[model samples]
Each structure stands twice: as structure tokens, then as C-alpha cells.
Target chain A: MFDNPERTNLEQLGEFGLIDHITKAVELKEPSTVKGIGDDAAVLDFSGKKMLVSTDLLLEGIHFDLRYVPLKHLGYKAVQVNLSDIYAMNGIASQITFSIGLSSKFPLEAVEEIYAGALLACQKYGVDLVGGDTSASVQGLVISVTSIGHADGEAVVYRSGAQVGDLICVSGDLGGAYVGLQLLEREKRIFLENPNIQPDLEGKDYIVERQLKPEARKDVVELLARLGIKPTAMIDISDGLASEILHICRASGKGCKLYEDKIPIDPMTYETAREFGIDPTVCALNGGEDYELLFTIRQADYEQVKGQPDISVIGHVTDADGGYELISKSGNVHPITAQGWNAFTSR
Target chain B: MFDNPERTNLEQLGEFGLIDHITKAVELKEPSTVKGIGDDAAVLDFSGKKMLVSTDLLLEGIHFDLRYVPLKHLGYKAVQVNLSDIYAMNGIASQITFSIGLSSKFPLEAVEEIYAGALLACQKYGVDLVGGDTSASVQGLVISVTSIGHADGEAVVYRSGAQVGDLICVSGDLGGAYVGLQLLEREKRIFLENPNIQPDLEGKDYIVERQLKPEARKDVVELLARLGIKPTAMIDISDGLASEILHICRASGKGCKLYEDKIPIDPMTYETAREFGIDPTVCALNGGEDYELLFTIRQADYEQVKGQPDISVIGHVTDADGGYELISKSGNVHPITAQGWNAFTSR
Candidate 1:
């Protein structure tokens, strides 16, 4: 989208040349990275630490819309989403492999912007870009990212470790990303209908940024460790709070009672949902791509997290016989069903 | 192209339902894998071994033609290509992450076939399917595989360690995969031209299989260890022998003399190339996707591999001043240039 006349065609450079160009600016800073980009595989040494591996795939029309998403933000968000999985496991991501496929319509500069954003995220998160595959696609752009991280065996968290009486907690706010997406989609529709109009996103920067550039909750994991509280279980909220909590309950063979009022919704998100005739609580429960951390800790450790500004106690784990329920602000108990966003169905 | 009329629509299963259905039969047999699937990330323990990570992406139309490629074979070959990268580094692949994107046209049965083939490869290679991401694409199918392997720090081989005077060796034969592709394209063209005509593919099974179901050289890596011979340098022959050897020379800052007469071409591959009015030697030099191992060894160990039927010593490393050269069968020397298959250029 830049107004640059000089554009290099990818056909002239070929695949290997493109790989060399993309990797030329990469600097490996991870101590565990023995080798990065140039060999058949990148060599890494975890040095007796447990390894965590996660992958994410983003497609053209399914996972994103290029009309509203910048290539740089797309690249940055791709890396962040994969790293979020590692953070969900209470691990520090160290290296990542990013593979992308694009049609000839993409110029060399566009590809550079994607890598620039990806590298920026890596630099900020202190991860090394190790190895990846690049190819020409038949249609739209496709991106796949795999992140590798490490943690001590005992320090690693699992979603199946929540026990009865564990306090259910969440970090940051929920529903902002989903609300931000709604705002962008509306603006896109308006712009499409009237080419002379500009998107009015001035006052919605906070919610819009949440959708465009959500960060993995690495700081939350760090905070929990700093407080000397190992979460009994943890998961990143990629598919809404209700769906993720249900995942924990299924995996841990436990039930949870979530308080609708305690589910943190940013004022912007709440107001936006209300303006759109959507219930704010429903937005918090069913919206996706928040990238916040949902975790559980023992009752004794609740005191350590109670005063944390970013952390909010939303619920508590219970016996499986209790069934999953949400207590509304009106003191009405409703059965929780997973109406999580499904990309396939949504498409 | 399945015979069953019953088809389960992907939209009906949703994303998580599809994931659960696909991974229902995955059995984890790797001791290094602590968690497989059903989590935000897979946990692995490499103990004291160094890890090797590699990734590959295969897009429809560019990488394969659905008219000739079976879904099962596509899945199998995709994993094999990625694992081959790990083997090229002289490491044993222990885990793999398989991500895929497809349109709504695909049924659950079709997706199941893809996974069946992938899991079959994992079973055969003793590798575990640790984690992956699945999504819906706007167009064609997309497959991305990442392989994780391990080796002792001192035991890993790189493409940059070849020294002058070391002999260049290649495992198995070259040019078969390329020739096989040519045969399949011919058959496809003929079938497209005449609806009633049955294309002739008889007695071409060897080359055809080489193209459709090539296996990674894991056995060759094991054989080398068993023979007590550590390669000075090694790389897989993915982009033809000439291009791969040039990679070694460039990485090592050395030149090489590749003898055309010493290059091994399967008899079927030679006949197929001649049948297509192509030079067999050129096929061996410039053909891609053979998945054979190319390596260098100390001259002292030449006697040990001299009688090996599968290994061929085709050249020797030389000083950079000597330049990259190919000695013809007529004893005339020609400077070697890389004409390796470039997917982007070819498209």
C-alpha cells in the first residue's frame, strides 16, 4: 500500500534468492539457537529444559481480510498468536520458524514489510527467527508460524491440572479484540459503499489496536512467577472466555462457576457492543481473539494475585457434578454452552 | 475420488470437532513427547540432546496437480519432505507438526484420508504427531509440516564442513523423481485430450512411485552411523545434484569436480529420460526432489564405502581457486552453473 514506484518482481529473484534477501537482516540473539537459517534445519540446544512447540496457520479470506489488515500487522499478529500458545504453557519462547506462500501479485517490497513486522515482534519478544519455507501460492497469501520455547519440567503448566476449589483468574480485559474487529468491519463496509468517505476510527484506537495488534500475555506468566504462584492450570483465550474455560473443565475433569459481572470488559468494548445491540456480557463470553491468559491457582495463593491491577478473579473450579454454570449479575444461574467462534462455520 | 457417497460436511463438525476427529487415533510412541495434541502446545523433552527444527510448505497447483496426486500420497509425501530435512542434518526426527488449510469442498472423509497417510508416515518413521493447526482456506489446499529432531551436539553434520580432498558421495540414485513427474504429466495430458483413451502407464511403476511416494533417507543416516563413518558434510538432493553441490561449495568456501560418468542414474530413469527425448545426464544434474542424501567423506574412509551398492562416490572437493567444474564422460571439463529447479521461476 506504500506509494513507491520501485517494485521488484519475485520471479526475477527465484525462491532461494528471496530466502536469502529475507534472512539477510535477521540477527539471532537466543542463546539456545545454535544455528539459524542456512542449513537443512536450525539447530537448537535447550540444555535439559522441557521444550514447547506450537503452530498457527493464517489464510487469506478465512483467517484475515487483507483489505483491513496491513501486511506488517498481519506478520506481527501471526507471530504473537503462536507465541501465545507457548505462554499459555508458562514457557518463554526462544525461536520461531515462519513459512509463507503468496501469489506473483505480491512484490518483493510487500514481502519485506511482512518480514519486517515479524522481525520486529521477534526483537520485542527476544525470539530468534530460525528457519522457514517460502513458496509461490496458487491464490491468496498464506502464512504458517511455528514457535519453540522452553521451561523447566516442573514449572511448565497444563490445562488439565486444575483441581477442585482452585480460583479461576483472567488477565487484562476480554471482548476488546472482538469488539475491535466489529468496528473495523463496519468501517470497511462504509468505505466500500462510499469511496469518498474515510474510516472514522479516531476515538476507537484502544479497541482497534486490540484487534489489530494483540500481544501474547507473556507478562502475566512472568507476573505469576514473580509472585511465587504456579498456576494449577492456564490457557490463552483465543476462542473466547467461555470456550477456553470449558476446555479447562473438560481437560481437568472439573466444573467451574463463572460470574458474568467479574468477566472484565473494557469500557470501549462494552459501549460498542451495546451500540451494536449486542449484550456486553455475551460479547465477553463468546467473542474470540482476546489473547488474554485464563488460569487457576490454589485458594491459598489467591491472596498473592488479589491486588494485582491486571489480574481479575472471575470464578472458581468445582467438582464435575456441579456442572458448568455462569452466575449473572441478577443472581440467575445459567448453564454455560460453548458458542465459541468457529472459523469454518463463520466462513 | 472416494467411492463412498456419504460425506460429513466440515462445517457441521466445526474446528474443534474436526480436530478431535482427526487426532482420535493418533497414538504417541515417542518417549520425548510429554504431551501430544489437545493442548495449546506440545511438550517435549530432549534431555541433553540438541534439537533440529525444519519446516516445508506445499501449495496446490504449484507443488502438485490434484488430477494425478492422491490425497493420501500428498499427505505422506508432505511429511516425508520435511523429515528429509532433519535427516539431511544427520538427526533422528522425533516429532512433527502438521498444519493444513482447505476449502469447504473437502469432506471429513477426505480430511481423514490425509491424516491417515500422515500418521502412517509418522508410524513408519517412529516419529510422533505432537501438534498442528487446521483452518479453512479460501481457495486450494495448503499443507505445512514442521519436523523436530535431535542429535548429539558433536554428531550433527552441516553443509559447510566439507574440506578439500574429501570425496563427495551420494546415497541411492538421482533424477528418478523428476522423470517420474514427467511421466505423470504426460499421462495427465493424454487423459485430458481424450476422454475414452486409457493412458499408458504400464511398466513405469518405479519412476511413478519415486515421484508420488518418495521416502526420506532415514535408513541411510542410520547406515552411516552403523558403518562408523561420520560425513564431513551432508545435504539432501532436493534441488538436483548440481545445485545441492554448489550449496556445499558456497557454504564451505570450496569448489568441487563432479564427474558426469560417476553420477548414478537408475536404469528405468535413464530409459524414461531417453523416451522423452531428454539427456539422462542433464536430468541427474538438474532434476529435483529425489530425496537422496549427498555427502562428503574423508578419502581414508573411501575403502569402507567402495563396495556399498547404494552409495556412489561421484566427485571430490577442491580449493576455491580450482572453480566448480564438471568432468564430462569425454574427459572435457565444463564450468558448472546452478540450474536447479526454481518453483517461482517455473511457475
Candidate 2:
């Protein structure tokens, strides 16, 4: 995906030259963006509104394997993940600063491809590319994106607001990204073993795409606003469902009762998990990188969200004294354990 | 400086636990910071002012050698450099997001020391540590800091506002950081050759400190404001003075004439440069990481700043056709060339 006919060495361009080259075509779309690329810092005006800020760092081997992950998709996913945090706060992302520490092994064309993917995401989300720093690294590519957003003071949501009667809701299906990762890793190993074979990704487009280029749930935030429903507490499902649920519960000083049967899993995700000899429910509970919104709403607002096509009412909030439990499909209860991604040990 | 008796593996704490431990003492001081460190994203209110945003990526080997650099000073310098960009725009920085990608070599205590230094900087500057990501790196440590600040619409400065007759001025002294780096590198080489030999850093405290913990000139920004002198064009001298001058000249469609003798160089820096068999003028011209403000003021405002103790009037801006030149003390004029730190090619 990153093959280019004419490759220019990065050293020939230097830092300033490379910056001028990459930002030459940048077009700012937000009126609030008073100043963009060239200045020491990007100037913005968010008068009368509250601002939201979040940052995420992605390392080459730890967060991704460049042998399988395309630079374009990596760039796009980096921005999407940071934007997911903003959407989790019920805010609209307005600007982003995309900085990279790239090694010389990457040519100018590779960096340009990464920027192309980043700009595409900004175009799609209406977020302005403000300012960033590009420095040479000794190892592989390192991407750090900081997203800025704005929202009305009263409309912003936090994870510590859920009440005992709040309904635990989630947007879109779960576990597809994890299943997709397994497919990619399996194919990568197979390809390494036998170079003659192509990747067996023919019929797994949905799951594969879910892993390669996950989208932030901006539509769900808009939908909630249109329906006049505000989540009492919210968080993006980057760490598996179990871990995120625990975070919300701990922050809100409450407990949660999650229903395994109510969790929405796509048919492809379920079949793939079974093929891998893994329980589908376990994947839904522990698999991560869904980029979906997990939120809680007041019981009085249940009527407004129950029938929504994209949202599923999977569980309910409970008192702090009540332990966090997951109701199994067979009418048995199990303690919710966080088996989410631990970067230090797992990778 | 980084000797910790109790060493705990990072894997034992996990990501969330490490973050909680590092940021446990972070006290938010900015009134605009509505919420910090715990939510999906930080919340701030820049209701009546323009916001300035900038990001920088610092890699371990390329930016600093950990063998000689203490983690605490590295963390502090990283924040100082990013804040320098905001101050270069004549903005008062209010918040920052500091993210790090660490390898297994770093223990929990080392990471804590880094955070301690970062928190100290935030406290001194009255900026809040809002939100950031902590991930495991496959190689050396990587830091990414995003600083956010506010400025009045009319008070903010840009690089593209210089005129034909603007006076070029600089804050504090130059070349000390570069000379300090040379001293450190020489000592590092000597120590590696024989472990028994201590570093010969006697009588070089000023230059060594300049390289280890350079301060951002926020005082200059305040001084400019106090004197009611708004710069016509401005940039922080992260790169050499020649490169920064070229940036302003290219952006503003003007040329410049810098007086070599007028450039500020500390006495220790000059003597050290002589000891290293390098010209003091060359060190002042090409040495980077000064973290000083290099700006241009209208000739009419020159009287207000000429006698300032820390500010030096280096030269004057000229028409685009005049070209960028430097006048030597020996009555020789030569075109100024940029030999700044080119990360891709130099290292």
C-alpha cells in the first residue's frame, strides 16, 4: 500500500524543508483557526464555549507492526483514536496537532503518505490541522496526536456522573476489531512462513477494516443531541468492555450489571472467534480498540434510546456495595475481570 | 541525580496504575482549566481569548543521551521547549499534555522522577497538566508535549509581520547551550574510555547548566508587554539564529542584516568555545537549543528596548532585494548561512 515509484530520501529535505513540503497543501476549514501551520503556534478562538483536549502516543512495534500495518492506515487510525476521546466527552473535535518522530529508513514519500491519511481524516471530520513538530528518530516511526474540541459547558459529559438507576448503553457492535487483529496476525505469520501465499482476507472485509481503520462515533454523538438525550456518564471503548465498565463504575462510585446476551456482536466477529477456538463472549468482554461509545443514561430517558438502531441497552448501573457482575446467557453470574491490553507486559 | 534504591518494574503497576502514581500530586492552578487528568479529555474555557497550540516530539537518542542526561532535567527541558513556542507567539501558556513512550529499561521510580520534574515546571509556570497517554515503547524513551495558551487577539505575534526597517532583537545569551553540549560530549567520551576517570567539568557550571536545564524566556514576553513593545515578527531560537532569521525573512518577504559582534554570548561560553578550538562567533551563529526569543521590533519602538540588560539589538531588517548578510567587527560583510541542527542529516 505504501509503494511509491519515486522515493526521496528524508535527509535531503532536512527538518524545515520537510515541514514546508508536508504543510504546503494544508487548507484550514475552521473559522476558529486563526493561524495554522507556519506560525510558532496555531492560534484559535473558541469564545463562549468550553474546550476539550486529549493526546495519544503510538509507537511502531508496540502499537503496530509496520510489516503489516500501512502507514496511511496508521496515520488515519491515530487521529481517529484521539478523536474518539473527544467524542467520548460529548464534544466536537475542531483541531489537531499531528507530530511524528520518524527514522531515516522512511523516505519522504512514506511520510507524505502518512500525512495524506491524516489530512483525509481531518477533511472527513472537519478538524483543522493546526501545528506540529517533526523530528528524526533512531528507531521506528512514532506518532503523537493531540485533539482539541469544544462543547457547551452544561452538555459536556464525564465518567463520574452515573447514578444507580442509569442505564448502561453502548454504540455499535463489539469485538470485531479484536477478531480482525487475530486475522491480520495469523495472515502475517502465514506470509512469513510461505511467501508464495496471499493473505486470506477475501471474505473478512468488515472485520479487517474494523481493525485497520476504525472510525470514531461522531454520528452517535450527533444522534444523541438530536434525540435530546445526554448520557450521564461516558467513555470510549478503547480498553475492552470489562475494563471500561470498571473505569466508569469506579469513577462514579457505583457497580455495574452487564448482560452477556444483550451485548451486540456481529455475525462475522462471532464466527471468527469460534474458528480461533476462543469464546465469543470472552472476546466481547476482553477485546479492545472498538472505538465505540459506552455510556449511561438516566432511566427516565430509556424510552428515548431503547429503540435506536445503533445503540444497545446492555446493562444497568447499581449501588457501590453491589459487586460488578456479568449475567451469563445460561442464567449464571460471573465476576467481571479486566483482561484488557497491558502495553508493558503483553507486547 | 537519578539514584533510586527502591526499583519497581513498570509491568507490575500497569498503565493506569503508573499514570495514577505519576500524576497523584498534580494540582491544577489555572482558572480556565475546568477539569484535569482524570476524564476522557481535559476541559478548559478560553471564553474571551484566542488560544495558541503547539506540539513537539523528543526522541531519546536524537534529542538527548540518557547516559549523561538525568531523567528529571530531560522532562523539564521537554516542557520548556514546547512552552517556548507558545511564548514566541506572545501567548501565556496555561495548560500542557505530556505523553511518554517508555521501554522496559525504565523503572517506576525513574518515570516518577521524570514526572516530578514535569510537575515542577507546570507549577512554576502556573500551567495545568491536563491529559496525556502513556504507552510502552520498543526502543528508547519518546516524549510528546502539547502546550496550550491564550493571548489577546492584538497581542499575538507572527513570523510574517516584519517590515523593511524592523530592528532584530534577542533575549538572554546565546551559544552557551551549544558549548555546554560540547563539554558534555567530551566528558562522556573520556568517561567511556576509562570508567575510573571523573568528568572534568570544573569551572564550567554556567555552560553545563545551560545544556542540562535551559529556561524559556517567559520574562522577555512579560518585559515586552510591560514596555508596550509589540514585536513585528517573532520566533523562539530552537534552531540557530540564522535559520530562524531566514524563516522570518522568507515568511515576511524581507531580508536582514545581522551584526556579528552584537550577538550575545556569555563569557564562559566564549572561553569554552575557544578551548574546544571553535570560533565563539560560529557557536553563537549556529548553536541551537538556546530557548531564547528572537524577534523584530519596529524601528520606532527601538528607543524603548535599546538599553535593556537582557535584550540585545543584533541588527535590522532590510528589503527583499538586499539579501541576508552579517557585518563582522573587522569590516567584512558575508552572507549568513544556516548550519543549524539538521536532525536527519547531522546525527
Candidate 3:
């Protein structure tokens, strides 16, 4: 509890005072904490495990639409996505620091709800909520999460390791989240246009759920560890399979050849895409927010994952001379293009 | 260079496409990087040293005046402040992850400048610019930095370790940054009134720089180490001294007695405070952003720091019943109050 003797002001005390005031109460619990408050960063000892680190931000209106987007899910998703980054690095998150910028619209309950979600996520993931910051925004809510993780030194995979001829694979199907978003937007339009319309969402449960309550592929990471196969390269299917593959291609100094027939799309996702008059494969290719694992493995290790139910091999890496191309079932080869979200993008 | 053959729209490609496009060109240099780009976070080898971790966020109007504040300093300070936190933890930084919410007002160069500042700080701190996320913000620029560092097992300090009668010490001086801020605001007002009058900033270099570029007290940690002394507890002076002390009192479950005369104020800072019609002591006590180190040391280690020029021993810890008190120059004791910046106090 704070003692408000004279009703002190933050501006009068300034930013430094606010930071010191808030942080001064934190205490170190372990000897591994060599330094805590005066240096460039906090230092720690994690025995011999590899270090993991990642950061992500949630912007109002862009990443989330506050109307139906609960504050709890927002907080949970902020931490989860950052932790997902650590998982993408093949690491187990141990600590996280979260930062938030909220407008006057936020009440005490709103902030607490956000923390509730974050705390719930921490408990679910077995990670500690280490530290964070909160501030007032001019107009919207913004949350940024940074997670620290630990992994075995030998078990980590990276996007740059996709050698020529490495088998490109993905965990589960994609495009469900995108289709789900489409369904939500459609419902949003109907609700906004006329309040009398009973939302026709009874049949689109899977797609809508995928859009609203997306889960990080934490299960896949544990499953991979248990299955005893480390991918040569890996990335999360956040934007789409095509875009993520290009990331691997450029990073590994190689090219990718993806099979349209092999691209996995959920039945619900396929149906929703057709209903929206979009190709299900295209939705899987370029749709965002899948949060699935896309990875490359050496051909020799295909035997390790041959009949796994959750995994599918969609393509193979090749030398750069072959170019970044997508092979369609009808023998059509199309060059991939860049079309991910860009802030500077005028459109 | 990107081959911008077909100018695909970002909204069409969506968030996933953007992530892939942005990450496509990254080639990680460290072999210690076990996995990257796909998981919850990036994984790096521990490499035998203790680690450090810190996170900080910079909001647009609250943290900086964009009219004069350059993007590079914003980026640099964002990283620097977090690094400073690690330093406060008595650790050496190794890795950092950044997440940014950029407004449409900024062009690519603005982002580059911010990163340039971040890069400079990384080079200075010997840390890797490992991973980050950049996304659109409807409001203003938001930069959040999460830094990791390593600390020796023996030298770590926490706020909860203060004992009854440990000497309170602070590195460097305070109030200069606050005074400097007053000057900046005053000048800003003048400039807004009429763009003709130049800023009357003669002989005001120290305070202005203090506001513009406050360095973290990294040297104090090294000096203390060299003096063969370990602080019982430590925190950086991001907030004011009163708030920081209150934090120590709450965390350590103890009270403290501070001497008004013992508080450190640089001569320039003192003069500036007076010029602004502020009590220099109050300014020093309540002003924030000094980025100095506030710590406590045992009585036995008194001789080790007694002769240090930059350090000041201001008070001592006491039992909970003693209560937090400050002895004035007139030999009058006043019970300490926990009053500092409150973001909601004004709103």
C-alpha cells in the first residue's frame, strides 16, 4: 500500500523516480543472481543449459480488437507469443518481463485482468513472471513481452541450418486461425451493421476458436524432444508457410521447393476458405497466426518421423540456383513473393 | 537487397507474411545460438558464465519529446536503461531482445536510427542484438528492451538483504537530471511561444546532458568490487531516493535512518535546483532518472568505501520498530513517508 501524504505527482518526480520507486522493492532469491539493479542487465547462472530469449509486442487495433478480445486473453497472448518465440528456439522458458502501455480507458480491474491472464500463462508454461513495466498511453493498449528460456546446448535448431536437400516439415495443419479471423470479422460486420441479427456462429466453432483462443505449439516442442529428432532448422508459422519458408531459405543461403499437394490444411480450415472464396492452400500459405512449427530435417532422419501423426514433410531445400519456388500439383512452378505485414507498407 | 518484382499488399499477405519477410535475411553469427526464429525464444549456450536479464520500455510523449528527441537516442537509451538495470543487478549483459510498436509517422530511417543507437549500446556492452519484433502501432513509438547478463555467484545483491545498521550508500549525485528536465521544459515552453528566441542554455551543459543522456553507474559496481566490499542490498536510482529507500524498507522488512546532510548533490545540480526555485534536497530526494546506484554495506566494510570520492554513505538500516526517519541539519527527526511518482495521481 502506498502512503499518499501530499498526493505526489509522477511528472514532478519524473521517470527515474517512478522506475526506482517501483523496482527498489524487488529482491534476489538465488545466488545465481550476481547482479540485479545497477548494471546493463540482470545476470544469472543456469547451470549449463543453453540461454533462451525472445520479445513480442501487442498493439491495439492491429494485433487485437478490444471489442470481443478480452483483456485476460490479451495479457495471456502477449506472454504466450513471446514464450512461443523461445519455444521456436527449442528452449524452455524460465523467466519473463512484460511491459504495458494503457490509455485512460483502462481501470484497475482491467490491469488486474491482464495480469491474471499473464499469471495463468506463467503457471501453465512453468515460467516465472520476473519483471515488467506499465505506463499510460495516449490512445491505446500496448503490451510487450520478453521471455528467457533454457535448453540443452546440443538440442537447439535454427533457421540457418536448412541445408540443400533438407526435408521441409510442419507441425499440424495451417490456415485455421486465418479462416477463424475471417469468420469473426464477418460476424463483427453483421453485429455492427444490425444489432438484431442473431450471430450465426453455431457451425463454425473450430475455426472461430482457432482464431480467438490460439495456443502456442508448446506441446510440439515437448513432443519433439520426446521423439528424439532435432530438426535442422525451425520457425513458427506465424505469417504463413510460404513466408516462413522464405525466411529459412534466405537465412540458410538455400532455396525451397514446397509441394502444394503436401501442404496440410484442416478440414474446417478448407471449408471456411472455400466459403470465403479463397484457396485453402493459399490461406495455409499466406494466412497469419497459425503458431504452428515449420522445420527442416535432413533426409536421413526422415525415418525418424516417417509415420508420426502430427508431422508432415511438405518440401525440400535446394541450392540457391534453383530459386524459391512453389510446385503446384498441375506441374506449375510459381516464384514466391514478399507480402507479409509491414508498418511502412502504405496499403 | 530485396527483389521487389511483384508488389504484394501487406494486408493480403497479413501478419505471418510480414514476420517471414522480416526474418528472411537474418543470419545468426554465434554458434552458441542453438535454435532461433521458430520457438518461444532464441536459445544460446550458457558458455559457463552467469547470466543477466532486464527489460525496459520507452513510451513516446512520456519518455521523450519527439519534437527534439532523436530516434537514435530513444533506441540507445531504451537498451541502455535495461542494460543499466542489469548493471544494478551486478551482472554483465550478453543478449537482448527488442520489441517495437512503431507509429506511421516514422519512416524506415527512423527505425534505422533507433537500431543504430541500440547497436551502439550493444557494441559498448558486448552483447548480441539477438531477436526482436517490430509491428504497427496506432499511437506513437514504443520501444521495449529485454537484456540478459551474467553475474558472479558471490557478488549478487537484492533489496531484501539489508540488516539492522548497514550503511546506506549511493553512487554519484542526484537532482541534476531532474533539474535538467525542468530546463528542457522551460526552453520548450519558450520555443513554443515564439520560434525566434534561442534556448538560453549557456553554462547549462551538465544539467542538459544529464537529462539528455544519463549514464548508468556501471563504474560503481567495478569500484566496489575492487574495494573488496559487497553491498548487502542494491538498487539503481531510476526513481527517487525516497521511493527506492521505501522499497528497501519494505523488501528487507526493516526501517532506516537517513541524514539530510549526507545526501549527495552535485554543486551544479544544487545551483540548478535553486534556480528552478526548488529545494535542492527535495529535488534530490524526489527527482528521478539519475541512474545512480543506491546500496547498503556492512559496518565492518566501512573503511573500504569511506575514502571513495564518488560514493556517499547517507544513512543506516534499523529495526522495523525504529521506523524510516530522516534527521535534519537542525537535529530534528521526521518520520519518512513513501511518496513518489504516481501515474494516476494527476489523471
For model 2, the stretches where C-alpha displacement exceeds 4 angstroms are A1-5, B1-5
Interface RMSD of 2: 1.0
List model 3 lDDT by residue over B163-215, tens digit each. 99899999988888889889988988999998998989899889887777677
Query: Which model is ahead, 1 or 2, in terms of lDDT?
Result: 1
Superposition error at B1 for model 3 (Å): 26
Candidate 1's TM-score: 0.99
Report the Cα lDDT for residue A41, model 3. Answer: 48
Per-residue lDDT tens digits for candidate 1, residues A5-98, read 6888888999899999999989999999999999999999999999999999889998889989989999999999999999999999999999
The local distance difference test score of model 3 is 0.76
Give, for candidate 2 chain B, the lowest lDDT window spanning 10 residues: B1-10
Query: Number of the top candidate by lDDT?
Result: 1
Q: Rank the candidates by lDDT, best first.
A: 1, 2, 3
C-alpha local distance difference test of each model: 0.93, 0.92, 0.76
Q: What C-alpha root-mean-square deviation, in Å, does candidate 2 show against the real structure?
A: 1.4
Error of 3 at B7 (Å): 21
Q: What lDDT does candidate 1 reach at residue A259?
A: 96
